[model samples]
Target chain A: MRAAVYHGPRDVRVEDVPEPELDGPDDAIVRVTHTAVCGSDLWFYRGESDRDPGSTVGHEPMGIVEAVGEDVRSVAPGDRVFAPFKISCGSCEFCRTGLHTSCVESDGWGGDNGGAQGEKVRCPNADGTLVRVPDRYADDEDALRSLLPLTDVMGTGHHAIVSAGVDAGDTCVVVGDGAVGLCAVLAAHRRGASQIVAVGHHEDRLALAEEFGATDVVAERGEAAIDRVRELTGGGASHVAECVGAASSMEAAVEVCRPGGTVGYVGVPHGLDGGLDLFSFFGDNVTLRGGVAPVRAYAEELMADVLQGTLDPAPVFTKTVDLEHIEDGYRAMDEREAIKVLVEV
Target chain B: MRAAVYHGPRDVRVEDVPEPELDGPDDAIVRVTHTAVCGSDLWFYRGESDRDPGSTVGHEPMGIVEAVGEDVRSVAPGDRVFAPFKISCGSCEFCRTGLHTSCVESDGWGGDNGGAQGEKVRCPNADGTLVRVPDRYADDEDALRSLLPLTDVMGTGHHAIVSAGVDAGDTCVVVGDGAVGLCAVLAAHRRGASQIVAVGHHEDRLALAEEFGATDVVAERGEAAIDRVRELTGGGASHVAECVGAASSMEAAVEVCRPGGTVGYVGVPHGLDGGLDLFSFFGDNVTLRGGVAPVRAYAEELMADVLQGTLDPAPVFTKTVDLEHIEDGYRAMDEREAIKVLVEV
Candidate 1:
């Protein structure tokens, strides 16, 4: 199998790798047909976060099931399916409560599992981790492309809205204009947010945010951004979705929330140059919520919307690549030249 | 007029002061009959938190309305009433949503309004800030005592539970055994928590926690406490009520929450000798919530429970003092010689 493996900082290679084999009764082999490079992936690529030099990369996977262990039931060979970034046991206490990210028996794609940005990957707890595409749309190319993001960004964006407890009449401030942030704008609109404010520096990304249902945008930085958002919100919005994992981004998210509001964060927290001071939110009675999102929990609902044409997060993939040029996808995203890169495997 | 004035650290004195007059049309002069020295007061008293030497201090005030400004309506001259720590205009956007603490027109007890620990307090936004007691309990000393804590700790404790979203069958871990923590145990039980664990160092307070409806108690510190709590709850609890604001207390509160759980805090954050790191909670998907609780928001409901004999936070006022010995009340609380002190004005 050909896989994208981490070579070192700024070096991702599509090289021949041994095919993954089922290591457990609940495992399944997936022949990935689509995958994407994530903002988080850049962490390791930039050498800012720890990642083994030879480890596999990428988490999102949309593919056809090549084989399934005898214990698997929800999915089987020849089924078109998609897997959430994290593998989970559906019946575990956490999973049963819709906290699949905290499932008692869980494993994440990439690394030992073989990268999703590859020809084949092994999925643990297939019944819990994989969602089969309806046979009717399995051969619908555009629909399949739309469903790809449900495996990660789209679901994570939904998690931000859910964690923030956004309501129909609420004002939501979305920090960052990345794929997840843009999806969050759409999610907030779908959840009936009366006003959605997208704050970021990129004019183009901010424009996409507006197209995705943002009622306002603030292209300022630091205190100026907080001031602009607070001004537009008459103090601050009732809900804030933090989609960037930077200390400054978290600060802006918290500062742009009204008293008794909530800041739902899906960003993988990074760059805590020191510790993040959260005392201001405490005084304002703002709740800090969310984490590594339970993307699996939200995938079904998000996929439903995508299929019904009520949501279209696929637009976030501004660029596309093939297996051999996966390195370009990484470069494009790292340089902010692409919102997200879709690899048509 | 007499009021409690801060002379310096460990020095509180009840001294003659200028009487309060109608400062605004929304004001009322409250003849405080009962007030309690709070745990937070000890912060300023011990010089741990900044306090002006000549500033009047105390937020809790339960009394008979001596006079009301022409515009005051919800409360009147001679009406028996109590005020939440922070005064708010009942009609503000924040107030309409039950976040009175963040009201656009807001003021607090203490300082220029005249300290609640004294003979009288001139309340701004009397209609919004003061809650009138029924005529039946206006002269009923015992019922009034039970309602006093509702002015602060009782409602604050309720805020913790509300913020944590504890529900039937949820296991709640309360970190702190102070009056607010003990009250949180009661609050969690009221909200129908199946199992309540109280964590604290004080044996007497822990015993009180059991009486207040904690199903278990962990009288340990640091790692031992975390380990014991994790073991007892089989990997932490679903809800954590943080009633003590110390960094360690917040850390313990977050550490004991299961993934997807929430930590509701009410302690006046004082000792932030350094920034607090919250990355662990982010990794676990646990939410950190609650803050300067909108005590007024939960006061009426809490008062109803207290008046109905279903909830009684009065026991937390374990000692009694009169105006002349107000300094003793402060000392008792500051020295940890009393859980709290009830001041008979």
Candidate 2:
């Protein structure tokens, strides 16, 4: 089998690798039909994260179940499915509470939970971690693009908006116009946010954000962006979704939120330290919510949305490549040339 | 009229000051019947906060309305009332949403918001800012002490527990043993927390916390305290109320919250900077809520609890002093000699 293997920073190659097989009673072998390059992938491809050499690095993948262990009940061989980035036991206290992203036994593919980037991926705890794709939308390419995000980014974006309690007729400000940020704009729109502000310096991404339902865009960063958001939203945004995990973006999210509003952050933090200003947080009564997305929890809902055409998140995919050119897809994402790159297996 | 005035750090003097008078159409002048020395008052008394010299330093006071402006309707002359430490115009958007502390027209008594605090205090937006004392408990000394915290600490504690979403049978952790922290312990108890852990270093405060329904007390600080809380609560507390505004306390609160649980903070931050960790936050799915307390929103409920004897938070007051001895009271609190000090006018 061939797999996209990480060799070093900005170095990846499609190399012949041993095919994944069902190892545990609950494991399933997925023949990758469609996988996407995520913004998180840039972390390892750019050497920003601790990526082991030769590790397979994809987490967003939807495919047909080529084989399944005896214990797998919900999914069977040849069944189309969407696997969440984090695999969970689904019975842990965290999972029971719908926090599958933080499932006690869940593992992230290629990161801390082991690698998954390959033509055939092995998923453990298949019954709890894999959601079968409905037949009505199996052939819908756009719906498949939407499925890729459900494994991570789109679910994450929805988590950011929902956890922040973004309701109808409310104003929301999204920091960082990356793929997840754009998805958040969509999530906010779907959840009935009356006004959405997408803040970023990337013109193309900002335009995509508008297409995804952003009512306004701020090209500035930090305090200037916050000031503009405040000006545009009358006083300040009722909810702020922080999609970039940097300290500056988090601070700006807090600053742009109206007193007593909330800031939901879903970005992976790098080089950030310390706690929030308790005085300002308390003085303004700001609520901050975020963490690993409960992807599995939202998988069914997001898939239903995709199937029903109520949400069209496929526009976030700016590029697509064959599995053989997965390396180039990673590079394009790392260089910010594509909002999201989908790899066809 | 005699009032407690701050001259400098460690320098408070009871001096003759001009009596307060109605300054706005919605203002009402009140002769303070009782004033409590708050932990925040020490901030100005110790010159920790940027406060001007000669500023009258009391904010938590219950008084009899002496005069009312033409537009004052809810509160009239001779009515006994309690006003939150922060004065707010109820018509603001923030106020309408039950966040009176963040009201656009709200002002703190001494810190930042320039307003008078003396033997006679003027309350603006009287109809919305003042809570009338029930006649049945107005003359009860203990009941009046209960009203003291309603102005700030107790209300703040309630806000913390409420924000943390402490439900019946859930385990809660209260960090800090100050007035607000102890009050949080009581608030969680009132909410039917099955087990409550009060983390603090002081024995007297811990005892008060225990009396107020803290089932366990963790005397250790930092990671050690977190470990104790985790061990005591099986895995970790379902909710944590951080009442100390330090970085270490905030970190501890976040560390002890179970995945999907909440960390509510009410303490005023001293000098903490930086934002929460996004990667860990995103991975854990923790919710952080805190800010200026919605005291006015909860005033009626809390007052009813006090009048009905379902809550007895007045035991937190360890000392009583005449207005002339306010300086000594401040020193007692600064030195940790008193849990809380109440002043009689």
Best by TM-score: 1
Give the TM-score of chain B in candidate 1. Answer: 0.98
lDDT of 1 by residue, B114-160 (tens): 98988989998899999999998999988988899888888888899
* Candidates in order, interface RMSD in Å: 1.3, 2.5
Tell me the TM-score of model 2.
0.93
Where model 2 places Cα greater than 4 Å from the true spot, the runs are A111-114, A135-142, A220-224, B111-117, B274-280
| DockQ for each model | 0.68, 0.62
Query: For every model in order, what is the number of clashing pairs?
Result: 0, 11
